[model samples]
Target: MAPLNSHSYHKVLALLAVIVSLVVTTTHASTITRRLETIPYLDYTGIEAAAREAISDTLKRRGVDESDLIARELLGPRQLSVTVPSCKKVSKRKEWRDLRYNEKKDWIRAVKCLQTKGDYGISPISDTLYDAFTQVHQTNWTDFHGNAFFLPWHRWFVWVHAEAMEHECGYSGPHPYWDYTLDYKNPTASPIFSTDPEVGFGTHGNIPLREIGQGGYKVDNGAFANLKVNLPIPHFLTRNFSAWKDWDPERHWGTALGGSFSPEQVKIALKAETFWELEAAIDGLNLTTFNDPPVVPSPDTPAPAGIIPLAGIHNGPHFFNMGDWNGPFWLLGTDWFPAGVVAPNDPMFWPHHTNVDRTFWRWQQRPGKQWEFNGLKGANRTDDPALPTDLLPFYGLGPDVPVALTLKTENWPMCYTY
Candidate 1:
């Protein structure tokens, strides 16, 4: 072994400092929560009167009018400022700098919040497709064209966030979508100012337009060529899930047919890789893995596992790596590269994770495996030297309302392309 020199010792000390910083940063940070918000109604006195009238009218079998419905059911008085935690915005450079060495598991957790996790301060308007922010600029901190990786990743992040929020929170509200092409002028007229440097105001990615030139994908000018290319994925969950099988509950969910799964149901199952090959036909693909750089495992495991898996860093068919789980890793990447464009407003992110949640639902549909807990007798969350057979932390679709399924749940009433 080489002898330790003063310079080497200094470098070691610096690395340790970085590690310490990351831990402190994440520990103190707060997680964004999905708080439910109802759209504003004009007045309460009118609402109650109209509500009484509408109910009486319906009972009388007379056609109810929109004005009456608006005052009664649709419109209500604005209550207190209903706010939920939104994903933390790294509004300044200092926040980003702190993330480098002190964020801990948050490096991954934050990325999830950026897109699909939760909106801290926003009132819950939960529905299957309800996403909080109306503009890409309002969604995250990473520069869109500053790098190519974030475009797809951010789109996916937003996608998963919206779906998960609706499923978990059960806010039956408007799940609005934006038309990326009508972007020259503000399409959504979002409550916030809608100016994003990446794609102007309302422009979302043109996969649909680009593919069929049908709706928003239709471009009139020479601007299409100038669109940023994030390489591997143009948008989120654009990658088929079956490719990563490490912790592929998706496959088990689908295969468990008629309400039950195999020995994989106990939590803490050791996965060989990260994802699965659930939908190779959509993009014409196969089982593949992200060419992840190694990670240092948490102290609980070996240090070799790295803080998190760079699982999203794979052959995304782009100029760089693409990911699902790996998307979270990219959010925390110190590496440098350019990503793609139109990701800021990509609507595909919402639909994609709807499918992802659909997968989670399908998993629940699998009958509780009688054999799932085989070979292991006693185990607790704190059990040391745990086996793969140990169970994991899980709950029903809604924590408020735990749902069981003869089959998994659906993202929308319409998640049946497969």
Candidate 2:
């Protein structure tokens, strides 16, 4: 069994949450807009000294840095406790490609294992993405063994990449975007929230391929928490992709980045830009919920979903039976294309999901994660980076973000250090 995650994060999460309110009561007071328009972009600036300075300066200007405000935000876990399926056992009748948790193992190899494979002939992330998305397996990591035994180890590798983005690249964002589309009533189209617009869209790939995660809205993963989906996720995970493939190209194009997006492609961001231009036309639209009240956004043609079926919440893949933990599981994007996530580069990824994060944060309105709950047996606990017990303040996050409760690849609290 995996060790309990402990209230080790309590002191820290509490420091960040500050408030216990349910509604998004404040965004009505004013519109701050995206900060990126005036912010300068450093060219391919890595997670080194110069990049650090640039991000730090920006956080300071926004007043999100290490002052009392940031300290106050680090309050408590805004997580919930929905039950996910127990997928510990794989069904033998299925092909390896059809395995229930195929995505989980594949994700470990594809995105996470790439670094190891590139450096040590032990790639996992590639095997996963190629196998699931491209439908090819037989990885270089396992050679002829066909063993996907590096689950824990590869999860470690993923944390390293997340850390590089945070520590080296000045990324202070959260992980496993809280999938908002799951809530039928809280569709992102509802104007009831106040998060970065790109939250729901996915990550913006605009960052030159060379500078993928650099210079974006920084998130603090320290407060990160996810519900379990325990199903054969690769199968279930791939379902969403399949649905996109089946969608009428003319319909769900924006939701899936489909065929209509050919010439210029469609893009939206949570940064201040969308508010000033993209959605600016809908500024005066009245909104009652994140659900389908039809707020009538600007530059609006048909509703964003048009025909793509915003009917289903944006949860990962809907199951034959909806599990309580399934929403968070899908939000985080697991075992399949787990090189972490795919939206960071896509414009709509962030705001669409920030609204999702707002939903997760709002879910705290219901009975939430039991502070004393030990979580799943053998589930990963330490993988945040720099680690709290290590006494190292996380390398990349700041302003409103802190490194105190941050965990290491082992999932334990890491203290700040170099």
Best by lDDT: 1
Model 1, residue 83: distance off in Å is 20
Off by over 4 Å in 1: 1-344, 368-418
For each candidate, give its TM-score against the true structure. Answer: 0.24, 0.24
Compared with the true structure, what per-residue lDDT tens digits does model 2 show for residues 1-418?
1221324333444422332121112221211111111112211112122222322332343333342332223222111231212223221111112222333233222332222222111123332211221111112222101011112122222234333333334443233322333322223232212222222121111221111111122221111111111122221111122223333345433443222222121222122121112121111111112224222122222323312222222222221111211222223333432222332212122233333223222222234210111111111222121111111111111111112211111112111111
Local error of candidate 2 at residue 404 (angstroms): 15
Per-residue error (Å), model 1, residue 291: 4.5
lDDT tens string, model 1, 70-158? 22222133223432222222111111112232231222223233344343334123221222332222223232211222222233343
Overlapping backbone residue pairs in candidate 1 total 65
